[model samples]
Target chain A: MTAKLSPRTEIRLAGEGGQGMILAGIILAEAAAIYDGKNAVQTQSYGPEARGGASKAEVVIASGEIDHPEVLNADVVVALSQEAFKKFASSVKPGGLLIVDEEKVDSTSAPQAIRIPVTKMAFETTGTVALGVLVGLTGVVSREAIEKAVTARAPRGTEEMNHKALDAGFTAAEKARK
Target chain B: MAVKLMQGNEAIALGAVAAGCRFYAGYPITPSTEVAEVLSRELPKVGGKFIQMEDEIASMAAIIGASVGGLKSMTATSGPGFSLMQENIGYAAMTEIPCVVVDVQRLGPSTGQPTAASQGDVMQARWGTHGDHPIIALSPISVRQSFDLTIKAFDLSEKFRTPVILLTDEIIGHMREPVELPDFKTIRSEEYRVTAPGQEYIPFRNESGDVPPLANFGVGYRYHITGLYHDQVGFPTQRLDEIDPWLERVNTKLDKHLDEIALVEEDYQDGAKVALLSYGCSARTARHALKLARAQGKKVDMLTLFTIWPFPERQVEALGERVDRIIVPEMNLGQLAYEVERMAGRKKVRRVVRANGEMVTPQMVLEAMEG
Candidate 1:
């Protein structure tokens, strides 16, 4: 079943510090704001450690002005690590969407979650594949918008690779939906 | 201009450059470090100077020195660094050096949390430095406001010849929002111009307005600047006549221009008996709560203060007279609420406060409204 979203959609991307979740959050916000002409605000919180600690970035997208720049009850939660899943899964609203990395997060506790091998796909292609998977599953932002944002923000010499990774994510989402 | 998604700290750095800021000296600190980082890369592209000072004290001193040498200068820091810069901040005020200090407050008292948000420095921003002094503190509620307010901070500092504080918190500093910045050519900042020739210049002469024209050092106008009480020519003095005038001018300069300096947004409904008042990150929460409260058929007024210092007493007192009660939500333990209470009366003001590194939720403010 397709995930239903509210007028104000709150998305939380959680992973380890080095996993580029913060960057994913920024790209997602840009996709909604710059490309789709929606209002978006992205805020992040991480541990003091630079790496190997739980980090989460939240994006609040709305058709109107976003007064509170944080996720009160996340409409979509993407967890790429077991710790992230444990910490943020409960924050997802009832009947909300949860997409977990199948290999990294063992149990989402929500049986209806859409599980995908996000990190493995990133290992095979590019590290930004999870963001692509998120957009594919929820379609919170248009696919073309996300692609443009990712390309605009991609590192030098890695745009093509990241584009391929996003294609793989969409393919996986298509299979899961079927 | 195409809209670009920019973080609040990054917007501040770009805003500084747009406001004709030619020098940045700051020590890296969480949340606020992005301001220094962006400036470090972008300053040189515009023929501006950026220095990674050894500490916040040195950073504060460096900005003041640059300003004295005739550059629009700024420094950014968190709470600990803000504390270290207190003495130099007072020095800037005493000498009437025009500079901007951006304080991205985190959970504080002393390095309480490196990555959390707080409005704990509201009082500190006003009175952190010792003694009575005039200060202009502007706080922004959004990333776009962050950019706009940073430029205002510089303009106000130059126009007032006083140190201005951009007192933002971690949430507003790190959050990202899409902003279409105005063209650089369209922006105007107050420049320090000495109309009087070097021979006829009196650095602190209160001849016309409260703010006397300042001349950059090494520009032929040689004058003494000290932390001590000074005369019209900036010379050190102990006499009552010289010190009294100096104190009067420095203290009341900002007060005379309260109409121009106090920036606030007032949203009032017809015959609204309740009002919501807040600033900085907390203002965002209050705005959300105002919508929720109004949706539930509550007549509520909301006031968002962009300029926090020099208090904006007249507007707030006027608000107090109009409303039966005012609610304040802030990410601190009643710092600004105290001011609201003093203006609106103790029984007429209620506070929804949090100091635990998390924002004051909109629900909390809504509950306060109901209570």
Candidate 2:
């Protein structure tokens, strides 16, 4: 019998410095902790420069204690930059999922990679760059959970645009779903 | 009430929040920046404010200013920034402002490494500010203790109307562990008696404690606060007799609370001939090392210090008499080891120091403990 997926999910948001990778993790953690009423832990590391630095944020959503916060061999690695993929793909354990932005990330080696064109969709829907791309990617991997998170978390005036951007991401991820 | 896994850095920020700190200002520095980062995001949500100032000096100053405006305030920094704020920290001491300072220490006499651990700031935390002052500094090894002691830092800072220092190393700051956060109301900040209405309010007058009741600026009361020596009315004092009382008042509070402030964790206390005296992250390794020594039929007792300042002179002296030889395994050349040697009142002590940034393991401390 095929066992069911546990409610516990560990996700990573990665990109270049200006990619808003940390915002994705922050929203995911807020959603889980504030809405779903589950435990969450968010950890990140970024290099010195704010522009070209490689940045990654790990969000672990578990029912119990999240020991070893470094995200030892993440079950899901989201790569938003080519540099980020090169750095994080090796750290993802085998059989775990890989979510990649097809437009920015060149994922020739990711075994179970899902290619979602978050960049193109982001530009088309929101007319902005980073926030749209972040919302799109966040909504895709998080499914409908990102909507509640964004509505609860986004600044008051930016809600309508963020909601639209999240929809764009969800549609893109659903189309690319294998 | 959720017992979630948290890093020590974030826990310190959470401790600040639970302790009713509504104002935070700091620049981003390694190991300590995470505290500011966490506070920056969460503070706005809780109706508090967080500011990333131009630099550490301005960051430290902004917090001091905000405290005078009637807000429980704090800032966090590592070694290099800590050196920059020494002059302002002295200002807080002289003015007797109530605030907490968190130093997640890193390796440095200067800008050495952004991610390496070191306890080289023991003496710096004690006497970093110029002139004479008695400061309360706490060292936390784990994430849970970091949260707990941060609350204590604010409590002591407010109770004594002085700046309290939370001295943590990079190892503890970066290390993540499970911690159960207590209720905000449960996290207590001492309530010192305020002055009665209409009557004169002496900002530096106290009947119960050595520290006076701090009166915030523009709180319908007028009082002078300066970096120079001051008397009961808060005016700067230059008289020789007043200077003696002024220095005595500052030193006596910490000295009086020395016994109560002393925190030690003793294990395997069977009159062990060899005593391992250590603190901070180095002591975490000693716990395992002492067990190995005990398994080998070696009599070893561990004295882990949670309170680093005021030396815990009496408790340390008592332990000094009980042990034949004291081994202080630290991360610096010889900071806390010097204190142990002084309290022991003899050269019957050895030091196992490491500055390599990769903690001194049990094997290293064991080798020193054997001799």
Candidate 3:
């Protein structure tokens, strides 16, 4: 095998019921692994019910072969629920950043937290169904290594919505930074 | 340029379409239903056939019948339904049919978890059919692989003239990922030997005697095929001598070609002392464990078995001599580890069993390697 080194990034999302956290992780991983020709591993954990249960999804994107599908301490965690925030905030590495939904999380514990209205955007986009798009957009706005992932993982024939959702997240993040 | 976000199940459906699979028969099960659902919608567009069988047994039978009718066919099922389809799988082996079965495996001995990730079916995919038979099972770690490997499963089934199973877990089945839809091209079918121009054709034998070149039914090859021991002409035979070799030949063709079928990925295997071995989703965890072990200055290597059937003896035997211990972590209660210890000898094999429907994490494998 010819040797080529690919940079690696781990993306994680955690939230309560119906936030599409798992969908976000899968879209990011698959887009990179399949479309960008990177190696990706996507995994998820859900407590029980379809409504109001703790849910978390992790994606490990690597240019080379992915050694681990399980990400113990994420380089990035997007928490969409208060329960998820309390659960996943400490799970991120000290240097890692935490993205949370402003409505759900108080944002007092996290030293470096970026508040994004993922749930509100999800509702406005297409009610609860567009949560997948919200998560997809977050992947696009990550400013990490997942931009390639957003373009790669969009639903077929939904390029317009994918672009709009991603731009929304990016603009939202940029505004928050300012 | 269709960059659609597809679930692993939907990808398998597209793969079945791309592989020229004209027939699909399956019952809806959690995680695996998307495969059936997608095929249901797409098959008609391509003038293919799709049937939601009454149960998995009928589903398996329908697919086999479709294969015999000169159509590439498949079925998808989860743990509970997969168990229902085992007997037909055995029948397919005896009849030497070419087909594919996708098992989006959920946790189970019996409905353990309806929609959770589990590698518990590793050995079940090999031996669940009962009786001795060779199996070709390909597993995918990513959603894209669910597509690519589904196509490969069909190719192998046609190549070996045996039923191939794409063993995927719920995680890989439900997880959506980006997949590059390859340019559509005509996939060539293997040459079939038939009774040409008013001659007797035996569906069970070929010129090379390797695999009986399968002829599609109603293709001018009027041959009878029954599960019982049969003569060269495809007629059932009662003679023990004839029966033994018939079984032997089917077994030998696959066994002799094991090298061609065995697929494994060796990571840092050179001059390694400790062996961290795994397959399916567990392979990823083992890779992490191997890295952690290496960082601690421990000599470790990783052996990932993609082709679990026929148990890559050559690789295992060679690795067995060099490693101090082979640490195997899986989501089941020591199903595959039993075979590993059997083939690699008992002294150095270790089993890290996890049966709670959760993944076999890296910590579990690392601790076992250190232990």
Candidate 4:
């Protein structure tokens, strides 16, 4: 059964503790597991400090059961902070996708990288940066699956703002692609 | 069936409710705290009861009392809290009460790393309470299995009229995964009923079966219940005739059902030379490592145990005979390895362990396999 899911896609989301990356990882996993009907496992590791500490969430999406939940060599790395980018830049698999926040990360080590002004767009629109990066990840995955996950997981009264942020993210990723 | 993406802890709570567990009493602890939280919210909606006890000791006692009053009951805790519940847990075992105790183990001797995962309590779950007794402990490696095994735990506890432990860890307790759970309406638990009025009801009658029928306390069945060695009438007994039979019945009930109690998953390839044995979260590590090894063209077989306690001696011995070397990886420092060594002999069993907060990675197990 696992043979069909050979070369599983691993996504690593790295940022500070309070940036909602854990929730973002869960949304990504839900998109794969519930919306896409693929087997997915999401795990997170954070320091004792609640904020301003290195934190990471990893999701392994496959067509079969996920044996190890931890991400080893990531197929996609989303770095929302300079610290996160410097630490996890090398952990990405060769020729894998590296998405970075343009203003946040200065490292240019990744040969093939996509820069999205996620924080600036969020601040200029929703006044929060977490959902923007999460939505932009959809450009790398299934847009419909991620949008559905955001609708299902986002708290009430914030759905409209989140949807708008998601649209902005899609636009930003599209512009980066061009 | 509706498929929902849920954390292992939430699935466990839902599993308990589906198993007809109506009462839960627990004090919060890390990793395992979510089980209590979910149950506290869901149990009420299902016409069940949930209480936050002062501590783990009271929590264990409360569940025992609820079970005696004719409700399926459970409690969840971590290593330190589990230690505090030992005395009352033995009380449930001695009284033959039906209940489930969930121990989501963390790294520990005393207040050890709370958020980290570990299989350190394997020995403690089996021998935590003193005296000769029989116990059933089931460990699940994935979130889906966590739900299924919780139901199984309740079923086994009710069937054998004993306390069963749902042994899990922080990794599975916190990891979120998609699962299509079993339909609740189709699930059935072993039944307990009152002896019809006017007929003599012996709570500990040891004649027909090892497990005497347990009647709910308030269901017109007036019987004494105690923690001491008890006679057929439930009164404390010291006589050899009464004590010997009571002791024998408790110990052999699980032994007789060893086939039902010992559940394992084996993946063997033809002409495989090495065997990797693991349980709980470490089993995931073993499976990942096995896949890596197989991908590299290494010949290895894997045995994953869902049943941890009353150790799967027969299965381990067979694996030991089939392969020249056996590797045991656990979150603790060789807790389950000790039992594997005892069964497969110390020389054949190799131990790979990590006690830190982090998980045992595939690389660690792969390196041990290569060595």
**Which 10 residues in a row give candidate 4 chain A its minimum summed lDDT?**
A124-133
lDDT of 1 by residue, B143-231 (tens): 88888898999999998999999999999999999999999889986566563454678788754347887888877877899999888
TM-score, B chain, candidate 1? 0.98
Interface RMSD of each: 0.5, 6.1, 3.7, 1.2
User: TM-score (0 to 1) for chain A, all models?
Assistant: 0.95, 0.80, 0.75, 0.86
Ranking by lDDT: 1, 4, 2, 3
When 1 and 2 are scored with lDDT, the better candidate is 1
DockQ for every prediction shown? 0.92, 0.06, 0.30, 0.63
- Over B105-186, each residue of candidate 4 has an lDDT whose tens digit, in order, gives 9889888878777888998999999888888899999899999999999989988888999999989998998888888888
Candidate 2's C-alpha runs over 4 A off are A1-178, B193-196, B206-209
Candidate that beats the other on DockQ, 2 or 4, i.e. the better one: 4
Residue B220, candidate 2: C-alpha displacement in angstroms:
2.5
The deviation in Å at residue B357 for candidate 4 is 1.9
TM-score of chain B of each: 0.98, 0.95, 0.93, 0.97
Per-candidate clashes come to 0, 0, 6, 0
Could you list the CA RMSD of all candidates, in the order they appear?
1.5, 7.6, 5.3, 3.3
Off by over 4 Å in 4: A1-6, A48-52, A102-117, A123-140, B193-196, B207-209
Q: Model 3: runs farther than 4 Å from truth?
A: A1-8, A26-41, A45-54, A62-64, A105-122, A126-178, B1-7, B143-145, B176-181, B186-189, B193-197, B205-210, B229-237, B295-298
RMSD of 3: 5.3
> Which prediction has the highest lDDT against the true structure?
1
Clashing pairs in 2: none
Question: How high is the lDDT of residue A85 in model 4?
Answer: 94
Q: Supply candidate 2's per-residue lDDT for B265.
A: 82
The fnat scores of all predictions, in order, read 0.94, 0.00, 0.38, 0.68
- Per-residue lDDT of B1-371 in model 2, one digit per residue for the tens? 86555678989999899888899999889979889999998888788999889998898899899987778899999999999888889889888887888999888889877767899899999899889887888999778889889888888888877888899988778765446788877765666635344656777663333777777676578777788887777787888777777777777777667666788787756758888888888887777578778889889878889989867888778888888888888889989988898989667678888986657777887788755
Give the runs in model 1 whose Cα sits over 4 Å from its true position.
A124-127, B195-199, B206-209
